[model samples]
Target: MTMAAMAVLPSRFIKCFSLSSASAPVSTLQEIASASPQGVAKVVLKKGKTQLFKYGSPMVYSGAVDRIIGRPPPKTGEVVLVADGAEVPIGWGLYNSVSMFCVRLMQLEEEASREPTCALNMERLLEHRINAATDLRRQLGLPSINTNAYRLVNSEGDRLSGLIVDVFGDVAVVASSAAWVEKYKQEIEAFINKVDGISHINWRPSVDILKEEGLDLLQLKHASVASPSQVEVKENGIRYAISLEGQKTGFYADQRENRQFISTIAKGKRVLDVCCYSGGFSLNAAHGGAVSVTGVDSSMPALELAEKNIVLNGLDSERITFLKQDASDFMKKAAARNETWDIVVLDPPKLAPRKEVLQNASGMYRNLNALAMRLTKKGGVLMTCSCSGAMTQSGTFMRVIQGAAAMAGRKVTILRQAGAASDHPIDPSYPEGAYLSNIMLRVL
Candidate 1:
């Protein structure tokens, strides 16, 4: 940023933002100062786009940028200051040259004033944010005797955008999506390794996402060595075999509360769990005294794990059975045979990863829900879920379910509406982080 523009900002703000004087470690201090000796690069925003970010939106899209001002242009994964049209510093963030998200704002001007030591110091900021996240989970009573698997850092929710950390037993799986996170992989690992009860760290990079952030795929692969292939964890007093290489961070800890709810309502009920990854809902249902539980999935490996979990928990295999079949196919045949269950749990994978495909995905969700509803006995309960952030953020998932009920010739009333568990906190500024819509309905 130019000295004249810097002059326009408050004196206190400037002092707190001065990288050279930041109370950071010497090595990190030198890196920040040397990276931009002429002062940090400034990302000038369009006139009308300043307020959204000023009001605490973490993502600074390329479309919002009017122009950039710096002697040597800032490279991707570098720290840069974000300024308004008149060149007033609104915040500072990690810059990306190729991605649609030009900048991921780390802290606002007010935040810097409060914690000046972290200003322009990514290392210090990471430590502070991660420690705070760890403390928050402790406050939420995570890693208790009954549950040791849960989300530790929820990307934007934890103020660490493009970074998700799920802790399972003694291992922590770090999912990196942004170029900056990749750049600071070692620093992140070092901090996470220091967390209590964590003995191993697994680095899982989002290949497609990093590619969009202008990263080299080959280098990304060698970022970290392999961690434990599998981990045994307990959730809601139930044992689970978590495969690190399975889906996103292995187990679906976000649905912990929702699964517990299933157990509560499964007593004496015949429960059918569609797209049951690793038999989470099915196991809960069985534990809750379900007369019979059927778990269906397309993944053979997932089903294998699910079956193993049934044996692990010492539950009656005859009472809870798993099937390897497509969700729609199983529901269709069950409905055709006039076979219905007392409760149906449909937790589909992300059907709409992006907003552009939401229209097409809605049809898929509707069809699945219609089939699920059809296979539900009269007055039976149906717990449906959509992990698509686009669908959940669009606020039309309920409408789609309603349309599905109309198609199935069934009347549905919502018994409950929920999102991810408490551990997966959502930042109001970034509602996109709010995925996993779990709605319970009474089908008639």
Candidate 2:
């Protein structure tokens, strides 16, 4: 059993609760059966609407939903079931009416394989999912190697739709979109502690998501004693100091292999890293023996961190230059000086957060990549990438790069295309899950 203690947050309406467990709380199917009437909400689907759940996809948008029945729409992440027009159950998932993704359905193959129409066994299933995601990384020999930081559990990829846990050394930085995690925080922490080398856990609450979802922050955020926000992590033998409150679970661990890949070809080359937040690629290039490495970014904190990282890694201080300037402006200045590099990297911020803005985002990408291409010496390598999943598909990004090359009046041959690291697995059923689009091209 778990006990909860509540404390007041900055907002009087918000109260934080912490739970303590005397021992490992092992939940059984019976708990779900007993809580079914209280926790589970029912959703009815319109006629002939079954394609999404059939494909093992987890999203149920507002348009596809029929009238909700029973238990008050699951109280924002309470478990809910989607039934067909005939009221036959399809699958169960967490419900959030305010978000366009009203409910995220879960596949019950194992439970259905045993007993059809049985209530959800959430705790047991969550444990199984976390363990399975972690075990695969173990089999891949990830944290065992010199790397101590990587994505431990990818959100939908790991089947825990609204949860993300990225491990940085002994610390597990967890982000949650579902209220279910809030309700069972201690148990979930226990499950994460089961992962090898994880003893500390940090909660990252999305206050912005709370406002966007039209939910009261008081109802969502819990007041908890704060810990030091900064932590140091090592990736691929490189040391990095990161803040938990910083971007995307502290750092871009998904680019682990991608950074190393660029390093292999960096030796004796003049390298340029655009949008070089914290100098991830630039530092790798310097370590890989690049003759000169230049990084450009607008963030002062990131540039300062890059300088610190350079010193921490014991790299040559003179070899890398971190410039505080807009990436596009820096590229134009280099081109004006008739400067060219043997390797040019272009990785911009997410220009398209939504599908409706793809055309505008495409124009920005085209301009950026074209500038990078123009600065690439003959036979030099151009590493271009896009991380916006909402708009930039793999093929679409490549096409944009090709258009950039055409605009730059340069001939290019694709050397290789890459995606996220092994730890950031892509579910085959949901190809859009593969967000990172990287292409290495030889410019002529």
Candidate 3:
């Protein structure tokens, strides 16, 4: 059969079995029964469609398919079908019965094939995605530090969909956000070990997102956690002890470069690190010869950990002080008290998780930076950061900071523009991968 004929026949048959004409939802069994052997056979003849067998065809019906089609049987797969206007094969995806993401496409075929295997090739896919990430890190000249605490794989950026793995020295933190990836955790752990120099692996399942996916959340399953009690990792030559049980994978690896940048200009200066989780920047500044450093955070546990890290670095405990207070509130109070600082660091958590909240999040960023600027001495450095991906675009975040500086009657000069560490490589195709945006401004 012709290629066009091959594509159309199976698609039509799969559509027939996969969906109902009356617009009613279809069950898995009904979807399978509706599949025509002829349509399946025709599509099987077409080349470059070998991987379809791993994931069942739309005609075969699966739990995922049933979830997409809310009601039982007779609904048309055409509801979520994406057709190539010209003679391209029809693409098949799972339809959501109740969620906003109504469809999740799985395959594109010229004709329906009854190979009974339409799932993705798990082993091959994993190898390809992992290697791609590894190659990118190497290309960027990373992996040289004594510490291996860097992101090894970043979910959709690596094309793995819902898997994120971070390497901290000899430990690997494997966090999964998808059911498919969770099912293959063992294989992923094995791959990390095979990469050499990796000692242990910790699994952190996506409890929040997994709950949304209607799956049971799992805990941190590790073989053994014994690489080091106070693992010393260097960021711009300043040492830090990373605790695994702490925040996202134990450390904010993304601020590695930015913290180092802060150290360069901190000599003989008094610095304030707002929202300093575990004092990542505070310690870096103190080590860089800052006369005194103050860290403000709301979490008492995090502040305690920050103090421990300060002691771990052999710095004078008196040089670094921690305050348990909200970052914005503290900044405002410092401004009211006229407590000026030679350098100020504002690194806040992600305020906007989605695009819809971008406006409110931008206003928050503006107000926070404005307060920070008001407390900064003339010619002093103000290093502000936004981890929220929604705020990192070219003009979006810069404008927010600019508005704050203008309102504070300060002329802000950009000394350096920084982003996440080398390990979190950004794909050219995915600009969103550049989530952490740090700007060093001198408020004159």
- Evaluated with TM-score, which candidate comes out highest? 1
Instruction: Write the residue-wise lDDT of candidate 2 on 1-444 in tens digits.
Output: 122322323433332222222353322333443465465556888776776666777778778887888744457756676766765566777777688777777654335445434347567767878888988888878795578888888877888776888888888998876655666677788899888787788887666765555567777665563445777788888888777777777888878888999889999999999999988899889989899999999999888889889888988878999999998888899889989999998888888777888888988999999999999999999999888996445357877888998999998999988888999887776666777887899999
Query: lDDT rank, highest first?
Result: 1, 2, 3
| TM-score of model 1 (CA atoms) | 0.92
Error of 2 at 231 (Å): 2.0
User: Model 3, which residues run further than 4 Å from truth?
Assistant: 1-120, 138-142, 216-232, 393-395
The C-alpha TM-scores of every prediction are: 0.92, 0.87, 0.72
User: Which has the greatest lDDT?
Assistant: 1
Candidates' lDDT values, in order? 0.92, 0.79, 0.68
In the predicted model 1, the residue pairs found to clash are none
Per-residue lDDT tens digits for candidate 3, residues 281-304, read 998899889999999999987898
State residue 311's C-alpha deviation in candidate 2, in Å.
1.2
